[model samples]
Target: MTEPLQHADHLLRAEGLECERDGRTLFSDLSFSIVPGTLTRVEGPNGSGKTTLLRILAGLNDNWSGQVYWCGQPRQKHWDLVRRNVLYLGHRPGIKMLLTPLENLQALVAGRQQVPGRVLGQALEQVGIGPWSHVPCGQLSAGQKRRVALARLLFADEPVWLLDEAFTALDVDAVAAVERLLEDRVRQGGAVVMTTHHEPAMQGMRRIRLGGAGEQGPVTRAVGEVD
Candidate 1:
């Protein structure tokens, strides 16, 4: 894990964004800015392209037409900066089922930074899955697997986060824990953008709906055209 720059003001801006699939328009001319110390929730009905929006911001999807700026520069121009600072946790747990939580976390963070085994253990405990740290993830419950994947957040110091359905499969206590983690991150000047149907109980959060008024173009229109 590359240590992200601390106390840095981060910004992610999308302008004139539009997307289409199977001859249907999902959203168009959607623009928003994610500022430091704030959590922006992306919400909309199903097929509204919430996941696509996150992917576009994370530089994982190029099927859409828009301009994304990281900090004050185009994201494409500072790919290195975005890559090092952004942490994306998708809907599915990315851990290997065959590996134990300890091994999975270690493998995930190995290339980015050198984290001690002790730290990993502590993180697992924080997520309430410490007792199963040695068990193979395949045998873990859905919620447990989710917790195992979430443990990575404890060690991740990234300045920007993009999460998709992070609260799924989590119980009430686990939900509160995850919310606290996001709150702490925002308080520390990190920014977060996530998509979820459940309302986040945290303060100082903003909302952006993908299929809201003036956000989607007619399906007959061109996909990438600005106007």
Candidate 2:
């Protein structure tokens, strides 16, 4: 049996995680814990199951067998609660090209936290896309579209963020803005788990590399201490 976590303050925990694709084992026996007010980065070479792990953590791909604990309890038992507090941003923009930036945000907002149009507009402005708020997402450049997708992070009230290659098309300024936003989230007692191949630009972030022949190891404080 896996040892019970010593730090009960963990916001996210995964134990004995296993994932398979096309009848081939991708990764197994993974475990990890994320504490509030911290940033955890998942790093590895290509085809290392970085995105797969993020999906499992976000409760999207449920084909795996393992246990996930949220806020010190079984995630399966409180899936709804976990869902409310977690935001998963994948490589795809996941935005509707036909909708304006504001409309896209309004459509994706969930739970009781409805961001007012003014606030959503402000978030877009912060991302340096205020001028394009009324423009259709399909008309925007790749980087602009990416920024629009990232704007969700600013307005969403979730306590945990899972991002896969979030910095893909961002410029230097946009990258700095994202780093600041994530920093603010951690300072507010929120937790973040992200997958990135490039060296993280954010300070005080913990990094863990994935990908191997055997079962992947659990995320530990040692991995989380990569500053």
Candidate 3:
């Protein structure tokens, strides 16, 4: 196997991040570092820059000004290296309606890594969509489609995950399952930075609140707060 670009000690770091949209400043001078084996949740009221922040971290939206580092190196210097290790799951399930769950999974991991068909089937089963693995995603309900998207987590080997409202269409049981999965990832030395309104039940999950009264700047919880 090829060696990883990131190490355990070298985590994600952002310095002096600033963003504005529609003439409104979303955030400025924001900074934070996410260490492996921990979860960082970005919180805020409506219209706050939670989504924008996640996108910036994922290198999806580059309108913001900041320096994002992966393993103490600039992202631009190692874009491919960083992108290979980071998985960005957006607010919507980026699934192709005409394709089956199996097909989607195959396409997603294509060129990155090779997986046997049985593994894909097992991953679908893990997410409770085993029987629908061969069915076109268009027939699945919203919750089911979300589950299909989440199935990526099962076979995903990325060290860092950026989830934006990932739990939106899930039911209570599914939500709990995802929470446990996230916690397990951290326990296994993976890092996650997500934006969600739902309070995470995972222990030691840090928080960043944006856009509140007297809180123009991002309010990051102290490291001591993780426990």
| Candidate achieving the largest TM-score | 3
Descending-lDDT candidate ranking? 3, 1, 2
Q: Which candidate ranks first by lDDT, i.e. highest?
A: 3
For every candidate structure, what is the RMSD over all alpha carbons to the true structure, in angstroms?
Answer: 5.4, 4.8, 2.4
Reference-based lDDT, each prediction? 0.82, 0.80, 0.83
TM-score of each: 0.88, 0.88, 0.91
Model 2: per-residue lDDT, tens digit, 1-227?
Answer: 33332434888888878787777666677777888778988877677688998898888898899898987799889887888878899998579999998888778774437778888889999888899999899998989989988988887777789999999988888887888888888787778898876676777887766665445543222265656
Return the clash pairs for model 3, or none.
Answer: none
Residue 128 CA displacement from its true place in model 1, Å: 1.4
For model 1, residues 1-227, the per-residue Cα lDDT tens digits are 54544544447888888887776677777777777787888777777788988888889888999888987788998898788778888887579999999999999888766899999999999898888999999999899999998898898977789999999999999999999999998888888898888898878677776653334443211122111
Which regions of candidate 1 deviate over 4 angstroms? 1-10, 212-227
Work out how many backbone clashes candidate 3 has.
0
Where model 2 places Cα greater than 4 Å from the true spot, the runs are 1-8, 110-112, 212-222
Model 1 C-alpha lDDT versus the unseen true structure: 0.82
- As a whole number from 0 to 100, the lDDT of residue 141 in candidate 2 is 90
